[model samples]
Target: MRRDEFRKAFFDASDRVHTYAVWMIRNREDARDIAQEAFLRLWQRCETVATQSARAWLLRTVHRLCVDRIRQRTRRQEVSLSMLPIDSFVDADATTDWSPDGDLRGDVIRAVVALSPEDRAVVVLREVMGMSYGDMGEVLAQPVSTVKVRLHRARKRLRCRLEPLCEKRSVR
Candidate 1:
């Protein structure tokens, strides 16, 4: 594609790409950086990336970058418990809907965060990105059957982890 057309495609896909990155990373600044890097890679290969598949390519690129980032962080010494940032739900902020009252939502977020990176990515792609199994398989470079199995296992684990919260809500 021409430079102008490539730029237009990048701009058009930016918002969803950023949102997906943010959901995967859960940090605004890091997400922005990841999205920018993905776009840069796309720009470098603009000739090869078909317009129709741009979104899928971008999504997959961002997902790979996130996985790499997590792996790099893991290789480094992890943050100590004492060094971890405080949960700010102490007072309502637009950042999260998780209040003391919405403990279930908070718990679910924790569970998701605790999940393995691949499992978490599959769950986010399916649930948050609303991608079909075939689309997810394309983005993830896995078979459709593998994508379905990963999504099913992820959902089952999430549901099992959140079951107590559901029961508590029902009791209330």
Candidate 2:
């Protein structure tokens, strides 16, 4: 494809790419950086990557970059980005339907943050990104059957973790 075509495609895909990166990495600045690099790589490999599979290629690139960033941070002993402060949702300027519920939403966010990276990524791709099993498999580099199993296990694990919290709220 030509430069103009590549730029258009990049712009078209950039928003979702950034969102996925943010969901996976949990830091706005880092997510932006990762998305930038992913797009750069996409440009670098544009001729190599098939036009029909560019979205999957872009997402897979972003995912790989996120994993690398996590590892680099780990080696440096930096706190995990996924471990955000509970007050992250306590904004007075924000409006959420769960605002009346106080800490329940925060608690759920915490539970999700506590999940393993792979589980978290699977959950985000399936639930947050609303990706199909085949699409998810393409991005995750797993078989469709493996993607289904992983997503199933991730959902079950999340449900198990969230159930007690829900029950407590219900009891109140």
Candidate 3:
């Protein structure tokens, strides 16, 4: 594809990419910055990345940028809740009534957030982005086998952490 075409592709995917970033990092402003930087990187490397899968390339770019930003920020000091912009979603009313235990949803979010970045990426890509393993592998630049292994481990950990919450709902 020509440079213009590549630019167009990046623009087309920008919204989804931004949403993915927000979902992964849980910061709207940071997500916007990540998406812009990813597209900028694509523009800079347009020639080399011309024939690569656009979706995968954009995702990988955004993911790498987010990771890098996280690492750089961590080097400065300890990470704490104060670092995250207060998200309005947390104040929103509960979405599900099925969790009679009264905090199952919050528990699930905490379990997910507790995961390491790599494991969290796997879970988010598979579950939230709805990417197939092959596409996820492309985005993650990992073999499908490795992606599957990571996904399995992530899900196992999530299940272990969430089981009590689920069981509590049943008991209630």
The candidate that achieves the highest lDDT relative to the unseen native structure = 2
Tens-place lDDT digits, model 1, residues 1-172: 5556877888888987887776666566778899999999998998898888999999999999988877776799655242112252123554465665466666766667667778888987877678899999989999999998998898888888789877987898
Candidate 1 C-alpha error for residue 21, in Å: 1.4
Where model 3 places Cα greater than 4 Å from the true spot, the runs are 80-106
| lDDT (10s digit) by residue, model 2, range 74-169 | 899998545445454346566454453445777666777677779988988887688999999999999999999998898899989999988888
Better structure of 2 and 3 per TM-score: 2
TM-score of each model, paired residue for residue: 0.81, 0.85, 0.80
Error of 1 at 81 (Å): 9.6
The residue ranges of model 2 lying beyond 4 angstroms of the native Cα positions read 80-96, 100-105
Q: What is the lDDT of residue 81 in candidate 3?
A: 50
Supply candidate 1's per-residue lDDT for 100.
50
Pairs of residues at least 3 apart in sequence or in different chains that clash in candidate 3: none
For each candidate, what is the lDDT?
A: 0.78, 0.81, 0.77
Give Cα distance to truth, residue 171, candidate 2, Å. Answer: 1.4
Candidate 1 TM-score versus the reference: 0.81
